[model samples]
Target chain A: MTNDNNDLATLALRDVAELVEEKLIKLLPKAVDLEQQVIDAMEYALLAGGKRVRPFLVMESSRICGVGESSALRVAAAVECAHTYSLIHDDLPCMDDDDMRRGQPSVHKKFDEATAVLAGDALLTLAFEILADEQTHANPRVRCELITALAKALGANGMVGGQMFDLLAENQDLDKIRITRLQRMKTGALIVFSGESGAILGMAEERRCQALRGYAHDVGLAFQIVDDLLDEEGDSDDLGKTAGKDSKAGKATFVSLAGVDAARTKAFMLTDQAIQHLDIFGDNAENLRNLAKFIINRAN
Target chain B: MTNDNNDLATLALRDVAELVEEKLIKLLPKAVDLEQQVIDAMEYALLAGGKRVRPFLVMESSRICGVGESSALRVAAAVECAHTYSLIHDDLPCMDDDDMRRGQPSVHKKFDEATAVLAGDALLTLAFEILADEQTHANPRVRCELITALAKALGANGMVGGQMFDLLAENQDLDKIRITRLQRMKTGALIVFSGESGAILGMAEERRCQALRGYAHDVGLAFQIVDDLLDEEGDSDDLGKTAGKDSKAGKATFVSLAGVDAARTKAFMLTDQAIQHLDIFGDNAENLRNLAKFIINRAN
Candidate 1:
């Protein structure tokens, strides 16, 4: 039964990933006469292989909320574009300065630093354009809600703010609460937005939205904890990134503050809690439930 | 009579600027505990004084098209935020590397480079949020139109692409056509959006929109040409920025490609052409006509 569930989750994730990728490919602007390089850079950064977890969250949440596939896919693509833009900027020389992303050269490394910056800016702009387009949803109110949620999540008080904290927190002693806050802002906010987007799209009741929010909160933390755990133990090749970066930088992570065993136990507990929040959706949220487990248990 | 027109233009510009500034102050996110610095950097960059020409264009265009002041002011603030974000990013070390803007240290210089990047990101994100808000317009379609216009203006094919071209065109032999195209993308796109936004808000006829487009097109180029002229001849103190950097970098500008006298002549011609497009609106477009002349004649 457990094996069957794992297979089902993997298949579902793969299916959504393919659909989202197709939509993203169609949505990205084609290379024009003089602006080819920037477009190429954008495509390169976005097309680099990842698990597409954020888009999956958007699609699965939308499906459970009874939104149409076209609207869901557009939002999913926008979420992915925003996520890719963040990664591109985060890898810049003044930021993390990582040369590799998803086992390939980072956008800044592949193109020039200036190109990387412009490409990132373009991608960020494109995300809002996608959300604002009429095809995203029949209801303009729904579109506006998606835009507001995304802006709030990605703004200074959320993802960018979290990044600022991460930069300052380097070499500083931080407790679990501070770390959690940092992670929540840096990684969890977008996840919450992705999940909540479905509720907005389907015009779900407030209780339904709150339950998804709760689920997103726990799942996002668990995902971050697992990231920390993987950084501590996973090989660079398997991770497709420079592993152990946190320990090398002396950054305070969950695994660094708590022992590996404690951190793993905590992630498992959070996964369980995240699943509990889906009780309101019952059988309709099976994929989400499996996703919570998959997030903590993934090898990379 | 000319002096009287100038005075009226100056007073009108000031009024719009003040309105936009007040709205911007209220619209920017308040500093939270840890993310206070990023918010500070965003405020610092945005509040740095300029002539506020883009917002003025938004306001004046909206007024001419019969849009309400409140909705127009919100969009005006949004335009300023987006423009400010571009300026902040343009000043980064990997980009233009300017240390000063509006007679003060640039955002990256005042803060750190990472903060500058994140603050710029936040501000850009905030621009969309403001446009997406219900306060921007009663009609969701209008809000979406504003967002789409801003996004396209600031996207890869627009401002970012123009910047990319500018970076690549440095020290390269380029003709007036290429230079104009680059300038249109770099600077003219946003100006066009600012003007066109009013028509979108008012739901004006296509012919009215086209008139604003023509005005924006000519005004935008004239604005860039005058910018080049100032960079060539104006004092750094008066300009509130380092002047002559384009010539110093061996950049091909209208002043460089065409001599100063010819470039000045072209600016005058463009301003006249821009005014000619406004004839359709008659007395309602008087402010816009004056604004066109001001674009060419401003000392700073």
Candidate 2:
């Protein structure tokens, strides 16, 4: 992509991030009483700030598929909620045990551990509620499709399964194949769902759905590769998280297997392949193509 | 209800319980591997015997509303999954912190705390996946409705919210109204969903739905009252849990507010009212009326 195209993509990303933030603020429970600390904690974690990459993918994919914007925005918010819930749980003392998230105290650190657990649970339940509501989609079929896709992506065979595998991978000899499978389940599943949500919402052709799936598959891996690289080289202040923790913990990562320079080259290759899968959509998919590049290039 | 009617309900409950257990066994992930300890923990926690009250409510409600047995069974299993997930999380060290459940060590005790947390998360995700699948109901409308109802019942304003209140109520003097609200959100919410699920599945008339809701409201409170009674007087051998723990912890409960005799009388009164609400269905609701009586009369 050219510099102008990059600028356009950057502007579009910012707009979508703002839109998602606005929708989420409206959707989240908001009362400032101490009695409802769980809701307060949930809102705190959700509104705390990220790149909104998943929501961007959902909205952009929906735009390319000609789906309605309002419905797509709701789905985007739901996806972000689920994503945030995962981050909260993953940072619990019993899990990855991180005290900081996005350069701020994690949910458990900000509130109590019990409140953190309940907040994560509430956010997850709210995501399903949002998708199941009739306002999200006029067609009940579409709603069920979204719920089913999300449940699968987040279930034992997907995100949870990946997390379990990751815990077990500690001090274990994980080869490239094992590590790839782990990343696919842990991180790739939701990314795939984000990409395919538009196809499901629009009831797109099988070929179009297949194209999105291919694009998501490569982009998801590339995203993980970039993440591994970032963890290795990025500063904690810039990344907004603890840096080099994976290496410190002796965990197997893409960068560990391929080295940082090789992993960077591999991420670029995957990004290029991901963009190629969007050629069928032409100019309608320009944002998605740019997103593929952005994933590999993002600083945080 | 007569002794014969009570016997008939007992037999039906046993049949439904067995069916639900069988379905859950098949539905749960199975593979005995070291790395799959999380799945094992979930299955272990789920299969531990209880009265299967929620599943029975679902099956009975569906039967009266003219829904299919197969789809209702799926919903019943899903309800149990959600219920079991709650129990697992409630028993976690950060929550209720109970070491024993159903006469066995809790999930966190049997496995590690991390495994228990992940298992609970997986089961919760699986419940939505089961409901959203086409096999649960041919109509996507029905699927969406089920998903929506379950999510509402389990979210912040429902189970999680109630839990937060319960935690806050510790060492505090909670009056009748506040305690009632807490129990309604905590336990009553899901029971209401179980009863109304049949109406949703059968697409019953608004009046019938309202009737079921009323029945659920009274029965749910009565059930909790009996629980408080059991906690005060029942034996650990029979209850499969520590008895008298509520008073020991100084947590306010129905019995704590009303005394044993008054609490027991209130339970009977609520059960009578619960039966009255089901009068619209006449003979079709015999099992439900009997179940209401059985809930108060149960030893455990």
Candidate 3:
């Protein structure tokens, strides 16, 4: 993928995210009068420096499925909400215990711990609320399908379960397969859900959805592998979050279990597999193909 | 308000809650085993005995509007999920910090804080998942409406907003109106949402829904007023949660500012107003009328 490809993916994501943000701003009730708090927390996390990878996947996958822009925007917003909630909770004292997120004070640190917890809970609930809104999409079955996909991705079988396994693996003699499963649940599940849910709305065949799910799974793993490698070699300023915390915590990471070179090689291989799977969609998925490459090569 | 009416309402609530519990047990996913922690927390808190007021409002209000049992059951479950999430979060160390919930250890105390937080997040997301499921309802619009209603009730204008105010009011002076506003937002919003959401499914008329909202608001405030009085007079075992701690914490309650008799009188007035609005439903809202009475006079 060329720089132009990454730029196009970034532009498309920014445009869709802007639309979703506008819709969210309007959909929230004015009566609460806590608009400032809601906006502050939302913009703080969303507009901060991290790449909008999940939302980008949602938009690109939907586009690949030939979905309408409006429908794609809803799914993008919903996925972002889920992603944001996880970040907030993961930063809590009992979890990752990070004080910074995306180059800013973590929600729990900026606000109070209780506020951060509530904000995450509120955002989590709001994601479903946004997706389920009648005006967001026309299909009830599709909406339901998206909800199921998201729930599974975020619930025990997805992020939280992965977090549990990661916690358990700390300082333990964890094997390659077990480590991969943990990473898959933690990050891969939501990424896969983001891709497949968009396809569900587009009336895509089950096989195509499955193939997209496979692509997402591989890319998601590759993304984490690269992240692990980056933590070892990337600049702290570039990463936004504190790098190398994984090794300090004795958490088994791709770069820890295998060498940095091995992780980098694995990332490339996974990206190739993802791109190959998108061959059936042909050039229609050029943007998604490029996005996969960008994930592997991203500096941050 | 009579003995016969109260007894009938009690029996109905117990019966419906039991049925809803049974339905939930089956609908839960077996593959996602991490759900057990959340499911146990929900069951422990849910079965610990409140009036099942919110779920009953969902069921009875839906019946009043002539919606079918299935839709009502789903909505009831969604309401319960939201309610459960609030309780779990409210019990956290940084929040109310209560050790006891429903006469037992709070989820945070029963499990760890991290598990409690995840359980709450799971339950919160699960509500929307339930609404969005195709098997839950035939109408897409209805599912969307349910999601939006529950979200609004749980978000800033409702539970979170109220909680924010509560956090601010701690060790601070608050006028009666401010206290009422806080209580209304925290507890009343969801109550109003429950009845209005049920009405939305049955009758699409905005005016009727508004009337139901009005009814819910008054009843919700009335419900809190009684709770204040009960904390001063009710038994711990009977109430099922820690009471009398609000005064100790210097928190504002209706009784703190208005006195017990005044608060009691206010509750009666609110309940009357709630009943007056139900005249729109005429004889069709007999259950609602009884429910309004039940909200004010209950010991727990």
The 0-to-1 C-alpha lDDT of every candidate, in the order given, reads 0.90, 0.88, 0.78
DockQ, cand. 3: 0.44
Native contacts retained by candidate 2: 0.62
Better of 1 and 2 by lDDT: 1
> Could you give the interface RMSD of each candidate, to one decimal?
1.1, 2.0, 2.9
Off by over 4 Å in 2: A1-7, A30-35, B1-7, B30-35
TM-score of chain B, candidates 1 onward in order: 0.97, 0.96, 0.93
Candidate 3 ranges with C-alpha deviation above 4 Å: A1-39, A172-174, A233-235, A258-261, B31-43, B171-173, B203-212, B280-284
Better model by TM-score: candidate 2 vs candidate 3: 2
How does chain A of candidate 3 score by TM-score against the true chain A?
0.93
Checking candidate 3 for backbone clashes, the offending pairs are none
lDDT of 2 by residue, A107-194 (tens): 9999988898888888999999999999988999989989988988887778888888888788788889889888988999999999
Q: How well is candidate 1 docked (DockQ)?
A: 0.77
lDDT of 1 by residue, B197-293 (tens): 8899999999999999899989999989998999999979977889899999999999999999999899988999999999999998999988886
